[model samples]
Target: MKKLDLTKQEKEIVEHALDHWQASNLLDVDKVEELKQSIEEKGFEWKTLARYAFWVALVSLIFSVLSLFADDAMVRFVEKFYETPNIVFCLFFAGVAVGFYVLGFRNKEKYPEKTFSNETLMLAGSFATAACIGFLGQVLDRTTSHYTLLFLLSIAIYAVLSVKLHSKLIWVFTLVALGIWFATETAYHSNWGFKFWGMNYPLRFTLFGILLTTFAVWGQKRIHVLQPFQSTSYVVGLLYTMIALWCLSIFGNYSSFDAWTQVRQYHILYWGILAIALSLGLALYGMRTKDNVSRDIGFVFFILNLYTRFVEYLWDNINRTIFFLLLAVSFWFVGRWAEKVWSKGQSSER
Candidate 1:
């Protein structure tokens, strides 16, 4: 029989188990050696290198595109193209988007392992789709900002494409479009004011995150088709909430830096408290439900919230030396606590 392929970590685990069995006289030394040889241990270094290379290539591609705006010749060429009717421009980019999307879909099916390249093509298609929508909005030329309408269109396009292609990458763009739509719609109505229902943008987004998270949880239970999106929605929702909480903790509801500075940091401590509470709640829920993603996010943001509070409350009031000493001591305790917890978990597993 063919032996199962194993990663380095999995090989180590199996080896440890075999050693335990041998020590207990369940297996002889020769059998242990044979078992070890049967399990192939593959290194993950190449995967790490590939991941970094992919990011470098992606960043380089973005820079190359941006550099086009700096070239006078390219600028002039684009200007001349702009002279064409807006509808024509829209159709041209929309067609390009469709071509790229189809190519990406085919590549995804045929060469599933070429993940980075396939995603790059899909991302290019998404950008083209955005350009098409932008030009289409300009062609329509409503008196209002019309940005909300464009965002809505983007959401619809991305959502539909995501569902059709079963592409989580496009689904992520759909979530982003939803966020942009919410922010822009609120801002347009407020005429770029700081307060919407006595809440700043960060505060409003915090509420928006809560709404999204809640809906994700409910939808996952009630809607069969949305099962694939549950993880994505939950993750994005947590991201939005955590980022907004961080911003809210620092700025509160005040629009201007001056206004914020006028108030004592303790006055805005409630926001920090709320952020910590939410993170802890999520962590507890994750523990209960055995959801690692939620637990990890919760723990990470819990630490972030603590650090943010420390900076806000202590940066100016305490001596630099004292602050560093306190920080070091806190980290030491946290590390020790984490070690104990990890050891306990390992023991339990054994």
Candidate 2:
């Protein structure tokens, strides 16, 4: 029989199962060794190190690029281009972005394994496209906060490009642009007020997140074209919801910090209750649907919400040492429980 391809963790689980089988006399020692030899274990540690190194290198590259802006000659050289029409720069960058996108696409097709390199080029193209759109927006209107319209335009462009190129990276940009547009639009409508429709920004975003998550779920079921976006949309939605809940937990519906400061934490019990209820509800739904991501998100945020409440309500009243000790104990129990659950899962899989 052909051996199944497995990750390092899976290989470890299999080896443990093999040892159990061997002890039970289900397989001979030689056969166990043969099975072990058949399994290929990739160096997970090396992969992890390489991933971190790539991020560090990318950060360094960004700083290096930024450093060029610090040079007087380079700054002046860029300023000299101010005399040129913004539309000219927009058109030029738009063409360059298109060229880069084409190259990245071709590279992705030819060398699928070189994901980092292809993605780097594609990322540059995305940034260039943003610059193009930004300059175009400025050319059309040099004054006022109408840049929100340009953000909407960018979202549209990115949505189209993501579909055409089958690029999740571009889709991520689309989501980001959409978020910016929402914020800008809300700000424009609210005139930078602390409350809109009796809710603060975080509370409002919580509603937006819930709506987006609902739409994503519905779209996944009804729209074939949206299937590829399901995971990304779900993640983004959860992030928005969790972050907004966290903020709401801290600040409630107050628009200003001064108002929040005057109000006691207990006064915000309703917000906390709502947040907890929603998180737990999502977790319950995830468990029923067998959706691990949703379940994990829900559980993690549930714990976070509880911890946040503890800090808010107990930090001042509790003894410092005893409080920390209790926290330590709580985490220890959580760790033990998680280990037990993980072990059971591994055994069941075996």
Candidate 3:
């Protein structure tokens, strides 16, 4: 038997087969075809793809500018006739979506790499630009329909990009949109105190559950990407704790503390002092014993204390810039403590 070398395409196919084998042991005939298609699509030059992206962006800009100035007389007239501009707007979106998908299939051969196509580029730009425009529109006028349209477009675009590019970023964005939607919907129907903090709390808890689940999934993905989950876990866990504490503070009455507040806000100062001392003590013990978990726990408690001041604004409804000054002083103390402990530990080790 004679040894033979394979051609370039054959080598590529063999390499792909090995990669796919690692991905899955169960081989289907369709898998080979899918792999071939994926390789052929992804082989296009990034520069060429970027050029297509540029053109798509230009087109989107032109459409947006035209929409801005074009005698919205037609839109206005339709609005009067239908009496449902939002429904019309949503329907327009549906039509555009269907048209885009149809165009995608019709031109599949031209853009072998679906991700690098002009259509995909335009879709991505539209989503990104719309989100910004929508947010700006909301800032300018709270009642503007554009903001809702922007959220709708953003959610749709993220869903499409997640599937098309198989990118985790798009998936994360989609998850974020869902979280926002869930929270808004929950707040709409729930009672203020319970939703804010009491016993009959179904909707608010549901919203919180969704947010927690999203964070858990995001954290798991981050752990894989980061090689160490420690930093992310510390930060996210602290944020969750801070949020929970804020919710509790919102519902909690300050009558007991109010008794002390009569003496020039002395009660808050007392609580603040206790919180600072406790965080400092924990941090010191953590550093002395080389306990990373305890150090993180200290950070969490310290953040809650710091954040409590902000939450107090909602409770007592104070608008004092003095609070910012207090925050600055507190952070300075935390920094000084960290620096001292870190330097002392390094000196001892040396």
Candidate 4:
């Protein structure tokens, strides 16, 4: 019905065979032989590339795991290789990153046919190396500013890697880096709970919450399902908002902390416990009704209740051992109920 377009070489091969044989309508054996040869050549090329990718991945995984245990030794190794001998630890990590790329380039030149695959794997290895170095800097308490920079860099790097590798698992590491940065910054401040808006963690969460809602709303209009950017932004934004709200109500109002007040400890305890119970009940109702805005608002009051309760037993009446025991028992009961509810949810999902 339809005619096939053959390349000049294919047409010549068919023509040559037709001249030698009494077969003009049948398939050409020469054409099939040429195809087989081409396939074998391409297959060999693909196998070579695959070997490079596999070895690179295996090496990266080994180095990453080893860095976790013999961290100091690895750091020194990088430092020596990089020649930044002062901070053997930091330099060593930096060197490893440099070396991975340098080796990738050298290997690419050596095996030109397998260049693309090896280069891709090398790039991934470089990211893992950088993330490790950044994490170590944070653990060593090099500086909050430095830690913040490292985590931000790691997040960006991993996000790009997700796109390049076409891997969803990379997103988990990106979220982890984001969470780490937020928590680290939150903890860096010397003040505890409910400081000024500029210095407060809740305010940060509130800002992130606003950002999430804005994007989620925009994304819902622009795209049907949640894109990677949308999902990441929304999840992180809600987490920050919730944490900030909790911090605000718990640490902001000093009057709620009866231990700081000159009131009788037992009177403070009774009032505080009553306040907490009412607020928690409201939060539960809000959650059940799917009133997110109301639930967020109620979370503030719930935090206030927790702070008051803590003050009553831990601070306000630290001398009252019986009250402390009662408080612990109450918390234990709540925890048990929570676990049961969570287990039921998991079972239903299964």
Candidate 4 per-residue lDDT over residues 130-197, each given as its tens digit: 65665466556554353666667777876775555433445556666666676565655534343334
The C-alpha stretches of model 2 lying farther than 4 A from their native spots are 1-6, 13-38, 43-54, 82-84, 347-350
Give the distance in Å from residue 226's predicted Cα in candidate 2 to where it truly belongs.
2.0
Highest lDDT model number: 1
Ranking by lDDT: 1, 2, 4, 3
C-alpha lDDT of residue 294 in model 1: 86
Better of 1 and 3 by TM-score: 1
Clashes per candidate (backbone, < 3 Å): 0, 0, 1, 3
**lDDT by residue (tens digit), candidate 2, 55-130:** 7877887898898899998899889887999899999999989998999889988987766667667777888999
TM-score of 1: 0.89
TM-score of decoy 4: 0.40
Tell me which of candidates 1 and 4 scores higher on TM-score: 1
Of the pair 2 and 4, which is ahead by lDDT? 2
Residue 279 in candidate 3 has what lDDT?
Answer: 64
Which stretches of model 4 miss by more than 4 angstroms? 1-156, 164-169, 175-197, 213-233, 249-308, 311-314, 332-350
User: What lDDT score goes with residue 189 in model 2?
Assistant: 76
List the candidate 3 regions with Cα displacement exceeding 4 Å: 1-88, 91-160, 163-168, 184-241, 250-301, 304-332, 344-350
In candidate 2, how many Å is residue 184 off?
Answer: 1.0
Candidate 1, position 137, lDDT = 89
Cα lDDT computed for each candidate against the true fold: 0.87, 0.84, 0.52, 0.57
Better of 2 and 3 by lDDT: 2
